[model samples]
Target: MTDEGDLIAGRYRLQTRVGQGGMGIVWRATDEQLGRVVAVKQMLLHPGSDEAVTEQAVQRATREARVAARLKHPHAITVYDVVRHGGKPCLVMEFLSSRSLAAVLAEQGWLPASNVALIARQISGALAAAHEHGIVHRDVKPGNILISRDNTAKIVDFGISRATGEATVTDAGAIVGTPAFLAPEVARGGDANFASDVFSLGATLFAALEGHSPFGEVDAAIVLLARVARGQIAPPKTTGPVTDVVLAMLRNDPAARPSMRQVHEACTAIVEGRTPELPALGRPTLVLPARRPRKRVVVAGSAGVCLLATGVVIGMSLAADPTTIPEVVSPPTSATAATTVASHGCTASYRVTDAWPGGYQAEVTVAGERGRRLVGWSVTWRLPEGHTIDDLWNGVLTRTGRHVKVSGADWNAVVPAAESVAFGFVGGVADGQPVEPKLTCRTP
Candidate 1:
């Protein structure tokens, strides 16, 4: 059996195990001949595997090397060599000091909108390149996305991917791909196509923003697959600016989905600070149930804070005097201001903190009217055309079409008269100056 420190193929020495999955174990190894570091993925052949299973595993390893080797893109992992070591197949590839998107999400919860946009742009470029080569990355999930310390994202693990005209490798009636990220057509036993990859990419972005899969977590594979087939995706509560594109990629009908080229363009637009021009998403055939109201959990403390549906807490500083809160002047009265107003003893002000070619960051501060004590507060605003919020912090954010809402987190739920709470977000704004969003506030 191969162990740490073992030499494989006489030219590579395993230093340590870097990753493991159902199909293989990845090790950080040294290419002795070249004196360079490399990653080696050793195929797994279970002791009790039948001849057919063993053969299939070998073919899969060989296929993975072939598929990945044919494509050359900055965001696609590179394959160096395929070798036979210790009677099993192994693939030598570039070693990256990076963590998978799944690992990052586990550590940081959800990513900011601008960050997700940058990642989506890179992956889309990779997918577009792959599609041009007649390759379909059948499995595109967070676990397969590697992010460097500098935040560059690379797509990896082509273990299940296949060329467009390739003969089927899977057994009859057997499905491939992660259930949580599978496209509806694939879940229903249809062949995986470029569109299917697009759908999967969308689901990956959904997980990056929502901190969970769109299908939610489930213990049973069959149950999860059924949910995917039914297309019962709960609306994402936190994808600020990328919401439209994410939803468009998730269209139940593959025909309605954007092509990888379109996806790349849209994502690039988001990264450049411009709003993406996406195709209209007509009503999908699979009707989703109305969203259930989010439940609140109140944690008692010196300052009563209520955890809202988004798992964000709205906090109040007990030591600060409510009367000391500063009042922000409302934007000059105009047609946009007609729809924006301070109400229910609260007012909100929006300011753009940073801006770039295709992306920008903004912050909102919500102040309570003098002497008004609000148990909870929610701020709503209308985004200008072509704009979308990608990610936010300090509040629970959700969007319904162009209307955006931010609710206080549980820790900041109590707004003692005249006191204020704030949240910030990054998003995309199409041409011209970033439009100032019209704002309104309410208490519940």
Candidate 2:
């Protein structure tokens, strides 16, 4: 749709059509009086057009009103006003000069660590803000994440959002979200709480880094439901710090999954270079085999750092197998706590999530090779300080003052072909030492 130099609702002068969705059309328009640009969302159907269609359209529009209006977050695209025009509802929102994360991926395969970090952090902030005031963004996907020219991530489309304990646009027991990005809870139609949002965050990051979902191809709802319902088999992301972070977000049990705050911290650590310390937040994490014997296509994890390889670029450490990664990370230094988390000597690039003295986290994702024979994999990193392991998940952990070692086993540690796993740590660090985490992947 073009501007066609048409005035919408007699107030907005349509400049150009930016996007179109299942529900309505989004046009970039100029406020004739204010002389400012705004996004006008005009529903496809009006009330007088058809009773059933109009009712459904109105329900969806009203859903946006309930969530977007109530949630005033910087990461979220702002909704100005919802008015009725031509017997239909029209929504005025802030015009955004950005492209969806999906478009970015389509244009440039997988994104870099820095871009992933920025997007994840901003998305988490949006989710946190929505949760704080009792709202949940039901559909969190690459399409929902819009990146501005300056690279700021803005979450859009609350047309499917749900508020806490409120009536929902969807019928009871109806599934929601794109299958690849759907949280297990939402997939099963059990509950859509803050934890579910965290799960979607993990899926979002996975899609960003690995360029595929754990669920693989999405054909129908029943199949996706079956995949999520099982919640055991995971994708083996190859050659990056993406697997660790995504696995943390895909916990089958909501209680087992880390909170949004913790999830943000872990992802931040990977994004900003801060060492991630996962507090035994009352959940037992799963540990996949480091290297699983698969089809005969060798995925070699070269010793040298992989800046960014175009071809498969599988970095698996499979007992010499590079597919599987260490399930648990040992804390660096012992500040007299059970889990000795260290900031010193931890060298790696990490994104800053919630920065406080000694309170830090890092998230990393890894992947296996596509069409390769990967037996096992492991990720190893040292601590800046001496920290103990309060609790461990998925893999084994070994630690000493100023040093930490994590091993991925073949028995339960092998990352199958074309799959990935996530590992994180939670503990305390010394009050003053600045934490820097370094990531190293190895095979036995």
Candidate 3:
């Protein structure tokens, strides 16, 4: 039995066990030589297990660790070193101060689709990089995704990942990975590949948004695997803006699915509130955004920056005088807005919806004149120095230093005459009053 503070390979000193699964036990340990903390995974072998099977597992882990080490991406966990201790392989990995997405879902049940999109965008970036290097992460379930306190997402545990062209490491016809998240072909005992990873990614996202596996949950592993093998994905009832891309990824045919790179791009678009194009669909189909739940608004005052939701007043600070509007740079109004704006351009309004220590929430609504129809719109503004956006939805957010741009998504792109489209964002500031930026809106 491994005890706390036990030294592994005469270098890594174990502190406490952090995780355990069928594959291995992960310990938080310190590398005395490097004076740093790392996660050390001790591959598990059942007591009295056959020696040959044990050796094969050790060899496989060694090879896979080498494969994981070759991958270098900000969104992927860093593999530091692999060592042998007690005749079993121990994987030294970066110790992140984060919790697994699986644990988050287990506690929260489900997340808003916009939040899920942000997570999907990050994980897809890491997985895309892996695919580009010909590495297939045979397992891509929620348990492998770590979300830091700052909300940065990184994919961990590439233990089952294999580089393309690597010889089979597991016993012949032996299936690996969690059953609920497996691609149909893999569930049917086919080889896992990049497309397989994409499907698994879809299943993981499905579980996140829908609160259950795409095949639904079953008590029997054999029954669940059968459902996955048959590609029996239940319809998504709550994914909203992410439904199209998620469904495209979960397509029944492996070849029909978009590449991991494409998935990343699509998720990125979703994070920015733009419609995703699925050329992989191979046919023309109108992709519509799913209905989103409305957020409540609290009106504080009649002046300064006021946030709105669902066309109702939201966060507004009550001024000493109800009629006194604060002096700030507001978006171009309908009158002077004509010359400085486009011929069929739009106008945008900004308001502070909510605020707290070090952070605030805001909303922006873009509208066209009563008789003028605005097609697609993009709003550009600038943030104060040291202020940054944390999260945004219903529009794409692009930031270059203090400059920012928010573009309308497909569903919100075409605003009928007299109607308006809006997007909201949460921002972080360093000890200063939030100021509404002068916004320039244009239509194309």
Candidate 4:
């Protein structure tokens, strides 16, 4: 066992143990040479394992680490380096102070619809980026999505990911990834592809919105695998706006599912409070009719087509809801008007404009005190745990762990105390209702 304070590669000094999984233990470490914080994940090999099997595991780990290193995106965790310590492969990664989506869901049974959408958008974006490089994330689940304190959703744990056209690592009939989130084909021992990744993502989002897996809450591994193979998904009750997208993604036939790009686009549209143009469902893969009666055989259009139509209706309904309309209060022209003071002479308010499972869209208004004309301004706040900001407008937003800082843009920096400057953002709330962050403002 590697003890605390062990130095690997003669540079990474382990500080403390951060997380542990079946594969390995992760440690918070510092690169003495680079003088920066990093995460070091050491691969775990079972005792008494065969030498050849151990070698294969090491190779697989090395390959996956190399593959993950190639992915460079804001929503994806950055891989810094890979090293070998004590005959085991260790991955050096960018350190992030964050909680997994699984932890968030455990704390809060279900996420708000808008928060779900924001989460899905960021995850889909990461998947799309990975897919563009021919990398398929076989294990796309809540446990792998890290929600930083600043409300940034980053896709992590690419340990099981493989590049397309690569030789299979697992045995021919063995399935990988979490059973609950597996695609039907993958659950049945089919090779994972880009489509399967999409299915898993759909399942992840479904769980986030509905508080359980689409396959329901079966505990037995075999029973869950059977249910996943059967692929009968229950519609999410709480996915208010993005229900159609979720249903379409959960299609039993991988071919019938939308691409990650389409999912990202739909999610982006939902986050921006616009009607998403549903992608055309792909043709279902042909299957031979079974001789014996199966528990459930999913029909293609029954779920996908119907859900697409339902989403259209929901879009229309939302468009017609007067209460959903945004009310952006512009700043006053005069500097002498009375204005409410927030923390440090700045008043701020947050409003949820639209929401769907896994994500939400919100507008934050920050106003200076009356008669105080400001040349430049910065707004800082602490996001609720498990919440992350995906996109924003009218401000430059940066997050460090759970603390978020938003600085006024060139166009909006000069604010008279009589008027307020407001900025909006789309974020994912994992644990509870999106709360107004404790706000502080600085003006110079």
Task: Give lDDT: candidate 3, residue 127.
Answer: 96
The residue-level lDDT of candidate 1 at 103 comes to 55
Q: Output the number of the TM-score-best candidate.
A: 1
Against the hidden true structure, what lDDT does model 3 obtain? 0.69
> For model 3, how does the per-residue alpha-carbon lDDT over 333-374 read when each residue is reduced to its tens digit?
321121223234678777765556677667777778554767
Candidate 2 Cα outliers beyond 4 Å, as residue runs:
1-3, 46-49, 52-56, 218-221, 238-242, 281-444
Q: State every prediction's TM-score relative to the real structure.
A: 0.64, 0.60, 0.63, 0.63
C-alpha lDDT values of all predictions:
0.70, 0.56, 0.69, 0.67
Cα misplacement distance, residue 163 of candidate 3 (Å): 0.9
Residue-level lDDT of model 4, residues 39-87, one tens digit each, is 8888766555587977877787778678888899999888888788987
Instruction: Choose 2 or 4, whichever is better by lDDT.
Output: 4
Most accurate candidate by lDDT: 1
| Clash count per candidate | 26, 84, 3, 22
The C-alpha stretches of model 3 lying farther than 4 A from their native spots are: 280-444
